[model samples]
Structure formats: structure tokens, C-alpha cells
Target: MTPEDLQTALARALTLAESGLVAPGAADGPIDVVAPRRPENGDWSTTAALRAAAHPSGRKALAEHICDHLLTLPEVAAADTADPGFVNISLTPTARARAAIDAACALQPPRGPWSNAGSGPWSDAAVDPNVIGALQLRHAAACRERRRARAAGITTDEADSSTLDHPSEARLLNALAALPGAVDRSRRLRRAAPLVTGLSDVADAVEEWLSRCAVTPTIDEDITARHSARLVLVRAAIIVLAAGLRQLGAAAPERI
Candidate 1:
């Protein structure tokens, strides 16, 4: 799924939770996502509720507050909380597939049929025997490379690149409001620890999603045009992530 889509949904839920808090400002910040360490749990987990535990409204109250709102988002199949208040989110299978398309659109609008060509969503079918194997490695590598490029701000079609955003990792941004200046090392490090941890965690969650939906590519494989478009959608997710990290001062990692 386009992680940002999930992040946007979470952000709205957070907004709802914050509205009822004693200090709405305290609830403001990036909402980190991670693959659940325990398989039995939801697909993505965030500690927004836990972070807001210190709020005047109380931890359980704040936690449940966010949980209630998260449940309202269609993209979120399920929302649950852990002790001390962590909200775990599960995406419906359909939502997961749609997210892949959204990710593709964020990179560049779907071309071929999904665009101004023939029909909508999809108008054809394609098949391949190697639909679920090492091919995923190539997709992963390509995604990582594009991610690197975006991180460096290397410049793609401006319109295409501009469509991607990493609001989930907004905490990583060293915005003027967060610190005294860019050179304030000690303070920056202090405030940034969570952001770094959050990035790593969210990457894992996104990876898990990608791993689940691996398929054929557009160039080397003999897949149908419809499947090719699906790959494009998957590829866009890499750009989405890279663009976001760049905002946080990522040096454009040479490799994931």
C-alpha cells in the first residue's frame, strides 16, 4: 500500500484524538509505523497513543481516543491498542491492493488503460508463472534505487516527483519549529532519536506490505500490459518513500 495513504488516515485520526486533548499541541508530530513484531497482531503499529500517555486527559483516554478515530478510516481494516496505549492497524486486503495503485499514481499517474487510453481501473488481464518469486528482488532493488534518487532530490519529472510525500515521517523533518538551528547538534540529536527510530520502523512496515504483493515487471518479463501497470504502481511507492526521507535530510542512501 502507499504508506502515505495509511499515514494520512492515521494523521486524520490523530487530529481527531488531539481535538479532545488538554494540550492538542502535545499530540502533534510524526506518526511512526512499524510491522508488528508479533505476526498475530495488526499489519502496522504506531505508538501515537503511547506518546500521548502523558496528556492531561490521561493515557488510556488518549489511547482509546485515537483508536476510536482510527477505526473510522476505510483504509484501516482494524485498530487495536496495547497496554499503555499503542494503536495497531490492519488494512483490508482490498485496501492493500488499492494502496499499491495509489503509490503508483503518486509516482506518476497510471498510464495505458487506467489513464486516457481505453477503460478504467483495468480493462485487460495478463498472467505469468513466476508471479511470486525472486522477481520480487528486482522490484525491491529498483524501488530502492528510485528511493535513493528521490532522497538525493536528483530530480525526476517535477510534477511526478512532487506528488510524493512522507507525512508519516514528518517527525524526522528538522523543521525550524523543532530546533534552534540546523547546527544545534546536542539538541538536534536529543529530539531526533525518535525520528530515526521511527523511519527504520516504518520502512519495515512498508517492506512487509511490498513483500506481500510482489509481481511481474514491465521491461524484462512477458507479462500483460495490465500487470505492467500494476508494477508501475508498485514502483511509485519507492519514490514516495524516498521523497519523504529527503525532506528529513537523508543523504540519499546508496542502498536500502
Candidate 2:
């Protein structure tokens, strides 16, 4: 089944357990579903019923009910209630491959901006030169401080200088400072430029910041204009990660 489909089925089963229709603690079982260690067994397997049985009645019966429900799904070739109430499921190979492909495709480029395209507040409204200047100055000062500490031969366990010593950090700072100008230039050259080319470059800059600064992106409407600009940079970095996962034939969940 598709990831969404599997998730939905799991949710439904959990709900049944919570309502006491199944054995107590079934909802809290260690394994949601299990796959066979040996290929001869089946595509997937589960000991959820056995785990649930530790608590209460009709565990085997409840497992059979769950297996019956799973067997109704198109992707499931068959589902059996094994000895001691195990639910083993065999998936159709075509269904498995299709699910994988859909997941990979969902990770493809330009998943779109974090900004809502409909009527709402635009980020440009909050941009402030003064705040941007202050942030830049603060970063520059920190870099200078690290350099001075290194020059003075002040070595301490608390002060790990490897990152600060890297030239890539300097390049990232330069890129961050130039982002506004680069974005502006991209807008001006819209007619001659590729649709997402400049945006991709901005994404690269954000990735550099993430690798160096470890900042997470958020969608806060109340943030200052300067912080909002940094949020845009973070969004670009997320897009880069998504693109990379797509190229690698892997899927990144929307809410990882």
C-alpha cells in the first residue's frame, strides 16, 4: 500500500484498540506491523496480537478480525492469523513498487514556496535594512572574536575552533550578506533567466548556513522583518534537501 494508506490503516487499528474492541494496550504495541526476516515467510508480518494478548481476552480472535480487515485492501495479497495470534500480511509486488515510486516523485523540485500564494501578508512588507545590518554586524563580530581567540593561542576544551577555522564559514557569511542583492538582481533579469535557477542558488546559500549555523526554519507571522528574511533563507535550505532526496530516489516526509 501507499505510505498514506498504510498510515491510515494503522490509525484505524489503533482507534479500535483504544475503544477496547481489541485487547488492552494493543494501541501501544511495540510493533505497528512486522516484516518477515526470511523471504519465504511473506512480504510483511506482525506480532501485534501476541503483544496485545499479554493484557486481555480474545487476542487471537481480535487478531483474526484485524487480519480480515487488512485482507480487504487491494494491495494486500493475503493476511493470515498465525499461531499465538500473529498477523502476517503479504503485499502485491506491483503495489509495493508503485508506492515507492509515488513517494520518490513527491520529493521532486519546486515543491513550492513556504509562502501562501493566496491573499495573505507578503514577506517583503517586513523587510528592514536596519535590522539586517545589525544581524550582519553581530555575525561579523562573532567571527572576529573567534579569529582573535585562535591567534592568541587560547586553547580550551570548551572552545572547539575547527568550524570557526573553516573557510566555508567565511564564504557562507559573504553569501548571506549578498542574498538580498542576488534576489533583487534575479527579479530584474526575469526575462532572461530560467524560472528556478536563481532560486536554486539561494537554496544553496541556505544549505551552507544550515551546515554551519544549525538553524531551523519556522513559519512565524510575528517575527521581525529581519528575522523573516532569515526564515526565507531557511525555507530555501529545506527545498534543497527535498531536491537532494528526490535525486537519490528517496522520500522525505512532509513533517519530518
Candidate 3:
């Protein structure tokens, strides 16, 4: 699931958990569900409960209650309390696969998520010839190349994230899932810098995955479900990056 999805779920859980303690509007702030810096922490974590708690003494209890509600979600596997008021969540592999496919499909024909139309979030911003802009263009080109390859049937099998066992695959999926939320957050704040940084993180994760896994194996026998799943992730990343770059008033050229 995307971070925004998780945030919405978390907010609902928090509201239910905070029933009598917090007033109706007290817990109406943005709920931030971010990828933990440390891998061992979990797929995503949030400290919104801490801020929502009426008193410091009840933070732990509120966190546990919210986690209890979060665990009810089918997409969620585990929701554990950490640091008294923080909740670390782990999504099911199937949910991850579904999320990646949803992202990829959202960019396909008809009306896609990323629009090249005039007057958008970044319409007022200037796209100068700076390093960040250059990097965004390069990544956009790479995404286009990858999407072209995917459309050519380099990955024919359906995406099955359950087959994804490599650490790189996990990291890539996690990064992909977080991109939409980051873009939304950036748009809400009316700033392109955070989205740019988030794109860099996704790029770094892609680089790491490429360094360790083969998206298109040379030998036919070596092609596996893991590779196909990775391709889905690549496609997802492509659309997300394209959407974010478009919002920044940048061009994702068909070729570099």
C-alpha cells in the first residue's frame, strides 16, 4: 500500500483508539507514515499517536490501541508498538504486489495519474538547468526506457511479490510504495524539494536492486518469478517518478 493509504488507515485507527481521550478535532493533523531508516524497524512507522495523545502517560496505551486497530487491515501483517507511542507496520507481500501493479496500471492509456496538462502544482515553479533538474530528467529517461522494455514483454509473467525473497527486492518495493505518499505530501505542502529528494531515494533503491538482482537475465533458464516481480516494481517506480517530475514542471523526454 502507498504511504498515504497507510496514513489514512492509521488516522482511522488513531481516531478509534483515541475515542474519549482526544476531542473530535484534536487528532485531525496529517499522519506521517514513513519508511524506517533502519531496516529492522519495519516496513513503515509512524509517531502520530504520540502527538495525538492527550497526556504523555497514555501514549503507550494509545499506541497499542491504534496498533490493535491497524492489525485488522488485510494489507497489514503486523503492527507493533515502538518507542511508547510509535507504530511500526509490516504489509503483506501480496499487498505489496497489488500496490505495485495498481501504480503501473494507473499510468497506462486513457486517463493516467500523471498529466502533462498546463496549470499544475509546479506551474508556478521554474525548472532551471540545475543538478536536481538534470537528475530528474535523467531518471525520467531511464524510466521511459524501462517502461518500453516492459511493454515489449521482457517480463511476461504476472507479478508475484511472494516470490520476491531478495533484500534488494524488498527495499525496492518499500521505496516504490512510499513514492505516491511522498508526492502527495509534497503537493500538499506546495513544494517540489521533498518530492525531488524522495525520487532520489527511489533511484538509490533502484540502483541497489540493479547491483544485486537481474531484471532481465541473459539465460532463459535464469528468468524467475522474482525477476518478473522486480519488473513490476520498476514499472511502478517509472510512473511515480514521471508523475512527480511532471508536477515539478519538468519534461520526461521519450529519450535522453
TM-score (all chains, Cα) for each model: 0.44, 0.39, 0.79
Query: Candidate 1's residue-wise lDDT over 227-248, tens digit each?
Result: 3333344354444344324323
Q: Candidate 2 residues 148-186, lDDT tens each?
A: 434443333332222222233323322322233333433
Whole-structure CA lDDT of model 1: 0.45
Clash numbers, per candidate: 1, 1, 0
Provide the lowest-lDDT 10-residue window in model 2.
114-123
Q: Quick one: best lDDT, which candidate?
A: 3
Which candidate number maximizes TM-score? Answer: 3
Q: Is candidate 1 or candidate 2 better by lDDT?
A: 1
Of 1 and 2, the candidate ranking higher by TM-score: 1
Better of 2 and 3 by lDDT: 3
Give model 1's TM-score versus the native structure.
0.44
Segments in model 3 whose C-alpha atoms lie over 4 Å from true places: 18-24, 107-110, 118-154, 186-190, 218-220, 249-256
Write down the RMSD of all candidates, one decimal each: 15.3, 19.7, 3.5
